[model samples]
Target chain A: MQQVIQANLKDNDNIEPVFSHFETQLNGERSSAWHQKRKAALEELKSLTYPTTKNEEWKYTNIAKVLANDYAFNAPSDLTKEEISKFSLSELEAHKLVFVNGIFREEFSDYSSEKGLHILSLKAAYQAHADLIEAHFSEIASTKEEPFTALSTAFAFNGVFILAEKSAVASKPIFILNITDTSDYPVIAQPRNLVIARENSEVTVIEDFVSVGGKPAFLNYVSEFKVEQSAKVDHYKLQNKGDNNFYIGTTQVHQSDKSNYNNTVATLGGGLIRNNLNILLDGEYCEAFMNGLYMLKDKDHVDNHTMVDHLKPNSYSNEMYKGIMDGHSTGVFNGKIYVRQYAQKTNAFQENKNILLSENATVDTKPQLEIWADDVKCSHGATTGALDEEPLFYLRSRGIGEDKARALLMNAFAEDVISRIKSETFKSHIETLISNRLENR
Target chain B: MLEIKNLHASVEDKKILNGISLKVNAGEVHAIMGPNGSGKSTLASVLAGKEDFEVEEGEALYNGQDLLDMSPEDRAREGIFLAFQYPVEIPGVSNTNFLKTAINEIRKYKGEEPLDAVAFLKKMKEKMKLVNIDQSLMSRSLNEGFSGGEKKRNEIFHMAMLEPKLAILDETDSGLDIDALRIVANGVNALKSPDNATIVVTHYQRLLDYIVPDFVHVLYKGRIVKSGTKELALELEDKGYDWIKKEVEEGVI
Candidate 1:
C-alpha cells in the first residue's frame, strides 16, 4: 500500500504546470480568507498524483491523452451576445449568468429579483454575501477524494453564486451559461460555483457548457449545492463543446431533512469528457433522483461517475443512466449507492444501460451498492448489449430501412432514461439534441 | 402470384423444409395443414426472408423475380406480407408511426410520392375500421403490453395497410379467442381481391371453418402428401393427424 501511494505521487510530475500556475499565475482576491484556503488547497493538490486507469474509480477511462497536452491557463475574454447567442435557450424568461473562460459576463445576463432570489458572481459574492459564501463554499464538495475538484479549488477564479431565500420559489428557471471560445492556443479553465436553497425553497438551475469555433480547450469545473430543510432543487448540466475539447466537471449536492435534489446530466459533445455527480443525502427523509444520457460517436470518450450517499434514515434515491455508443466511440458508467449504518429503511436504486451500435464501439458499466444498514432496500443493475435483434428484424421486416430502424431503436433505448425528466421544456430541449445525435450516428 | 419448387432449407444444419414444392396464383386461398415439426412455419419464414433460416436449395419466384434475392423490406415493398405468429413488441415506436413509415417507405419503393400526415391518417382510420383496431391502441407503442389477440389483430391491421399481393398468415389464429379469430378472418376476407392471394398455415382445421380455403393440402414431414378441396379439411379434422402420419410412414399416398 505504501509503495502504491508513493508511485501515484510520482505521477504528479506530469501535472507540474498545474501547481505552478496556481502559485504564480492565478490572479484573484489575494488577501481574502478564501485566498489562504486556495493556497492551502494548492499545496494539498501537489502531494497527490494524476488519476489514471490504475485507480479503481477511473479503471475504464484513460487520462494519458488529456494529461500529455501542454495546457496553460488563459485570461478571460469579453464575449458578444451574437457570438454566444446560438447556445442560449432564448425562449425562456429566467435568471441568467453568462461566463466566458472563467470570468462572469454580466452584460448578457438578467433576472427578476422580486422573489427573494439572490444571484451574483463568486468573486463579487465573496464581498457582498460573505456569510452565505463562507458557509457553503467548499463546505460540502470536498477536494480531498477527487483530484479534479482539487484542481478546480486550487485555481478557482470566477463562477456563479445563487441563493434562494427561506420558503421562496423562483418565478422561472435559472440559466448558467459557461461558454469557451478558444480561437487561439489551447487553454484550461477552472470555475467554482456555490448554490444554496434555503428552507422550503424551490428552484430550477441549468448549467450549459458550450464551446465555440471547435477550439482545443480544457474546462475543470466544480459546483456545490446545499439544500436546506424541505427545499426542492432541480439541477441540470448540459455539456456541448467542440470536437477537440476536454471537460472534467463535478456537481456535489448536500441535502437537509425532507429536501429533494433532482439532477439530469446530458453529455453530447467533447472529445474526452468525464462528469462526477455526487449527491449526499445527509438529513432524514431526503430524496434524490439522477437521470443521465450520453450519446458518443467518432472516437469520443465519455465517462459518468455517480454516487448517491444515504447518510440518514428514511432517505430515498433513484439513479438511471443510459448511453448509446456508435462508430468507434466509447462510453463508461460507474454508479455507486452507499447506505450508512444509521440510514435505516432507505430505498436506493441505480441502473445503467448501454447499447453498442457498431462492432468497434464499446461500453463499460459498473453499478454498485455498498450498504451498511441492514434494513435498507437497495438494488443496482447494469445492462450492456448490442441493439436487440428481434426488434431490429421486426422493424426491417416492415418497409423501414436498416439505418432508420437502428436509429429508431437507439432513440427508444435513450427515451427510457430521458422520459423520466419532469420538466417539459428541458425534456424537449434534450430530446431534440439527442434526436439529432442519434440520427447522425 | 407465388411459386416454389424443391425448396429445401435448414437452421444450424437441422433441415426443416425438405423439397417443398407449391404453386399459387392470385385470388386463391390455400390452407396448409400439418402436425408439429413439419416445417410449416419454416416455409412462411423463408418466404419473408428471415436471416436465421438458410435456404439450402430452392427457387421461389414472385412476380417473375427471385424472392430470395431481395431483403425483407424490399420483399415487403414488392407486395409480400407475413402476419407473424408472434409479433415483436416495440416499446417506444407507436403503431401509428410504424404503419405510416411502412406505407410511405413502400410507396417510395414504388416510385410514388409520400403521403402527408392527414392523408396517411385518413388511410389509417379506414384500415383501422377494417381490422377493428382502436385509435388508443394505435397511439401506444407497437404491440407492447398487448394481449395475444391484440397482436394478431395488429398483424392483420398491418396487412390491411400494406395490401400485399401475397399475404401469408403463419398461424395467425394460434392464440386468438373466438371473437379475435372472427375479426382476423373478417379482415382477411375484406382485404382479399382478385390480385392478391392468401396462404394459411395451421395445425388445426378450426380456423379453416371461418376463412374457407379453395384447396387444403396436408404437409407431413416437410413434404405435401395430399391435396384436395375444402372437404379435405373437414375429413382431416374428423380423422385426426395419425391417419395421415401412418399413411406417410407406409409410403401410401
Candidate 2:
C-alpha cells in the first residue's frame, strides 16, 4: 500500500492538507449523502496518482509538471459585470449561467423562462430537487476509477444543474460560462456539472471555458448528461484558457432508447489541456455524434480521449475530430468504439485528421475498436500531414500571400466540423474565434 | 512582355529544361507545342515560381525584372498568371472568397485600396459571363468536385479576374471538350490586349483553332528545336510530333 501510494502520488503530504481544508469548508453538508459520496471519492483519489507518460492512457500527455504546482482550491475573484462582459457573446440569444472559480454567481446569471425547464446552481438544486440530484449525480460518471473525475467529485462544491422534464423543449439554448479568475494568485478549480433531459425532452447546452488573469491555473471540470428515452441533447464545449492555464475536462453521457446526442468541442487555446468524453448507448436505436476541432500554437498541448460504447442493438455513433498544430505545440487523439455481444447492427465510424504547420509540431492519434457483435459496421481512419503543398501553391499563385494561403487552407480544413454546429450565431462566433487565431499563424 | 534567355531548370537534381529560350511581346500569343515528357509543363511551372523546380542556369526576364528572384505570390501580384494543367480542389474555400482575397492582396501589394463587397460582387458577376460560369458554382468550394471541363473553364475565369500582363496557360485545353475549349479560348481572347501577352503550352493543336498564336515553337528534349508561324502547328498536327523528334535527333532543321 505504501509503495502504491508512492507510485501514484508524488507528494502525499501536500494532498492531505488540501483535502482537509476542503472538508473543513463542508460544515453543514458534511452529513449529507452527497458529502458521503464526496468522502468516498476523496479516498479513491488518494490512491490514484497523477498520471505520467508511463500510463497507457497518458502516453503522449504528461501531467507531472501540472501536478507539481500548488494552487488555491477555493480561489477568490473580484469579477465585475464589465470584466465578465469581455468574454460574453452578445450576439447569442441564450439563457446564461456564469460560474466564477467553480462557484456559481447568481448575480451574473440569467435563467431560462421556459416552462418544464429548471436551471439552478448545484446547491439550489440540492435543496429544491434533491431526488433528481441524488439519482443522477455521479451515476452517469462513476468517480471511483478516473483520477480527475474523482478529484472533481471530491473537491467541487458548486456547478450548473439543469433538468428538462417530459416533452419539454427549451425555447432557447442554455449557455454556461465557466470563468476561472487567477488575477490574484495561482488557483485550481473543480466544477461538477450534471444535466438530465427526461423522456422526449430536448435542449442545447453550450459550455464556454475561459480565464482572465495570466497566472497559472488548473480547471478540473466534470459534466455528466443523461439523455432519456426519445430525448435529444446537443452539447458544445469551447475552451480558450489563454497561455498560463492547465485544464482537464471529463464529459460522460448515457443515452436511452431512441435518444439522440450530439457534441461539438473546440479547444483553441491553453497551455496544456486534456479532455475525456465517454458515451454509452444503453438502449436500441440510439444515435450519437461527436465532432471536435482544436487549433494549437506555441507550446500549447491538447489531448482528446473519446469512447463510445454501444450496449444495445441497432445504435449508431460517428465521430470526426480535426486539429491544426503550429509552433512547437503537440496534440493527441485516442478514440475508442465498443460493441457489446448483443449490440448487433451497430454502425460506428471514427476519423481523425491533423495538420502540423511547423516542423516541431507533432500529433499522435490512435483509434481502438472492440467488437463482440457479429453484424456491426465500423470504420476508423486517422491522417496526419503538413498542409497540402498543392493547395498552398495553388493559393499563392493566385496573388494570395504565403501566410494568408496557409491560413485559408487551415480554416478550410476546420470548416467541416464548424459547419456541423446548428446555431448560426454560435457558428459565426466560433468562425470568428478560429479565423482570428489562424490569421497570423 | 516576357523574355526567356537560355533558361535552364531541374527538379531534384534532374535537368528538365536544358537551355530553353523564347521571347514574347505584348499583343501577341505564342504557342509552345511539345510531345509528352518534353518539359512543356516544367517551363510553365518555372515561370510561375514553383518551388519544386530549381532554376539551375540562365534567367527569365518579365518586363526586364528577374522573374526567378520573386516569390510566387509576388510574381502573381506583378501580373504573372499560370493557368494550371490540373487545378487543385480546395474544399471549404469558396471560389468567390478566394478570388476576392487574391484581388485584395494584390491590390494591397500595389498600394491600392481593396474593392468593397458590393464592388467585388459586381466585378464577379460581370466576369462570370466570360467563361459562362454559373453563379451557384462560384459559391461552392474552389473547383471541388468540378468536372474536367469546369475546372479548365475556371482557370479562364480566374484569368479574366486577375487580368495578368503575362498569362501562361499550361495544357489548359487538356481533357476539355470542344465546346468547353471554345469557351475557355474565347475568354482568353476576350481578355487579350496590346498591354498583355499569352503563352499557350499544349500537346495538341486543337486549341489553336480558337485562339490562334502569332508564333508556334516545337519543344523537344528540353530545347526549342523549331520556331515557325501558326502554320507550323497545322503542319505538326498533320505530320505528328514523330517528325519533329526525328528532325531533332538528326540535327536537321
Candidate 3:
C-alpha cells in the first residue's frame, strides 16, 4: 500500500497546479463563516492522498489510469447555442440550467417558475444568498477521508444552487446539465452543487453530465443536498459522457424528520466511471430509496459505491441496483446499510444483481449490512451470473432465435429495476435506450 | 413428417438414447409411454436439438432434412416445438412480447416480414382463446409466478402462436390438476391439424384418454421395446410397465 501511494504521489505533480490555483482562488475570496470550513476542507485534502487499488472500497475499480493522466483545471468558457442545445433533455421540458465545462451557461438556462423557488449558479448564490450556501455546502459530504470530495471543495466552480422555500411545492423538476468539450486538450472540471429543500417543501432535481464530442476528458463532480423536516425531494444523476471520458461523482444527501428522498443514478456511457452516493437518515419516519442501473459494453468500467445510514427509529431505506455487462466490460457494486442501535424498527432491504453477456465480462457485487439494532428487519443479497442457458433454450424452442432470446432475457433482468422508476416517461426512455443498445450489438 | 434411424445420444458421457428408431408422417399423433428413467424426456430433448445431449450415432430427418444438423433455433424455425416438462419462468418479459418476438423470429427465418403490432395482437387474441388463457396473463411477464396449469396452458399458447409443424409435448400433464389437465388436453386437441404432427410423452395413460394418439411406443432402457396403436396405451395402463419388462426379459414381442 505504501509503495502504491508513493507511486501515485510521484504522478500527482501533474494535478498539483490545479490544486494550487484552487487554493489561490479560495484565498482571494472574502472571509466568511463558510470560508473557514472550505479552508479546513482544502487543508484536509492537502494532507490526505489519493486512493489506490489497495483500498478495499476501490479494489476492483482502478483509479490509477485517471491520476496518471495530465489534466488541467478548466474554468468558465463561452458555449454557443448549438453546443448547449445538444445537452438538453428533450423528454423533459421543465426548468433547465445548462453548465458549459462546469460553469453556468445562463443564456441557455430557463427558470420561468413564478413560485418561491430559487435556482441560481453557485457563484451567484455565493454573492446573493451566502448564508444559506455557506451553511449547506460540504456539510453533508465528508471531506476528511474522501480525496475527491476534498478536491471538489478546493476547486469548486459554478454549480447550480436550488432552494425551495418552506411549504412551496414546485410543479416542474429542475434540470442541471453539465456539458464537457475537451476537444482542444485534456482537462478536468469539478462542479459543486448545493440543494436545500426547506421545511415541508417539495422539489425534484435532475443532474446530467454529457460530452459534446468524442474527446478524452475528466469530470470530478460533487453535489450536497439537505432536506428539512416534512420535505420531499427526488433527485436523478445521469452520466452519459463520451466513451473516451472519465467521470467521478459523489452525491451526498441528508434527510430530516418525516422527509422523503429518492435518488436514481443511471450510468450508461463512460470510459471509466465511479459514483459514490451516501444517504444519511437523521430524522424519524423518513424514507429513502436509492435505485441505479448501469449498462456497459466493450471495455468500459463502472463502479458504484452506495451507503445508507439509518440513524433514527422508524426510518426505512430500500436500495436496488442492476448492471448488464458485455464484451470485456466490468462492473462493481458495493452497497452498505448501517442501522444504529437507536434505529430500532427500521426496515432496510438491498439487492444487487448483475448479468454477464460475454465470457470475459465480470462483475463484483458486495451487499453488506452492519446492524447494531436487533429489532430491525434488514436483508442484503448480491448475485452475479451469466444468462440462464435453459431459459434461453426455452425461448428458442418457441421459435425465438438465440440472439433475440438472449436479448429478451437480458432486458428482462434489467426491467425489474427500470420499472421501479416512478416516472413513466423516464422508464420508457430508458427502456428504449437499452433496446437500442442491445439492437446495435 | 419425421424419421429417426438408430438415434443414439448421451449426456456427460452417460448413454441415454441408444439405437432408437421411429417414424411419423404429417397429420399423425405419436404417443411415447415409458416407465421412469426410460429416456422418454431424453428423446424429446434430443429431437429439439438440446446442446447438452450429444448425438453419437444415427440420424434424424424432419421434413426430409437433417434435423440433428441444424441449431436449436434453426430447428425451431423449421417448425419443431417442445413444450417443456417444467416451463421456465422469465421475469419482466411479458407473455405477449415473448410470443410476438418468437413469431417474428420464426417468420424472419422463413423469409417473411415481421408482423405489425396490430396484426400480432389480433393473432394473439385468437390463440389466447384456443388455450383459454386470460388477457391479463398475456400482459404479465412470461410464466413468472404462474400456476402449474397456467404454465402448461402458456406452452400451448406459444405453440398456437408459432404454428410449428411438429410439436413435442414432454410430459405436459405432470403437474396439472383434473380440470387443468382437461383444459390443456383440449387446447392441444384444438390445435391439431392435418399438416402438423404431435408427439406426446407421458408416464400415465390419463392424457392419452383426451388427446388420443395414432400410435403408442414403449421406450424402455433408451430403446423402443414395443409399438402398437392406441390400445397399447390402455394395455400398459392396465398391466403396468413391469409386464412389458417381463416380455422384454423373456425376449417376446
Q: Please name the candidate that would achieve the greatest TM-score relative to the true structure.
A: 2
lDDT, candidate 3, residue A310?
96
Q: Where is model 1 chain B poorest over a 10-residue stretch in terms of lDDT?
A: B217-226
Q: Is the docking of candidate 2 incorrect, acceptable, medium or high quality?
A: high
Regions of model 1 farther than 4 Å from truth: A1-29, A76-79, A112-114
Across residues A190-279, which tens digit of lDDT does each residue of candidate 1 receive? Answer: 778898999999989888888865456778889999999999999888887666888888889999999999998888767889898898
- Per-residue lDDT tens digits for candidate 3, residues B27-62, read 999999999999999999999988999999999999
What is the Cα-based lDDT of residue A338 in candidate 1?
Answer: 93
Q: To one decimal place, how large is model 3's interface RMSD in Å?
A: 0.8
* Model 2 misplaced regions, further than 4 Å: A1-28
* Each model's backbone clash number: 0, 2, 0
For B96-207, candidate 2 gives per-residue lDDT tens digits of 9999999999999999999999999888888999889988889899999999988988999998999999999999999998999999999999999999999999999999
True-contact fraction in model 3 equals 0.84
Error of 2 at A209 (Å): 1.4
Position B165, candidate 1: lDDT: 89
lDDT by residue (tens digit), candidate 2, A1-441: 111111113564566667776777677878888888888888888788777899899999988767766677666788997889777787899999898877788888877547999988887888888888778898889876688888888776799888999999999889989998888767787778899999999999999999988788888899999999999999999998787889998999999999999999999989899999999999999999999999998999999999999999999999999999989989999999999999999999999999988899999999999999999999999999988999999999999999999989988999989998887888899999988988855
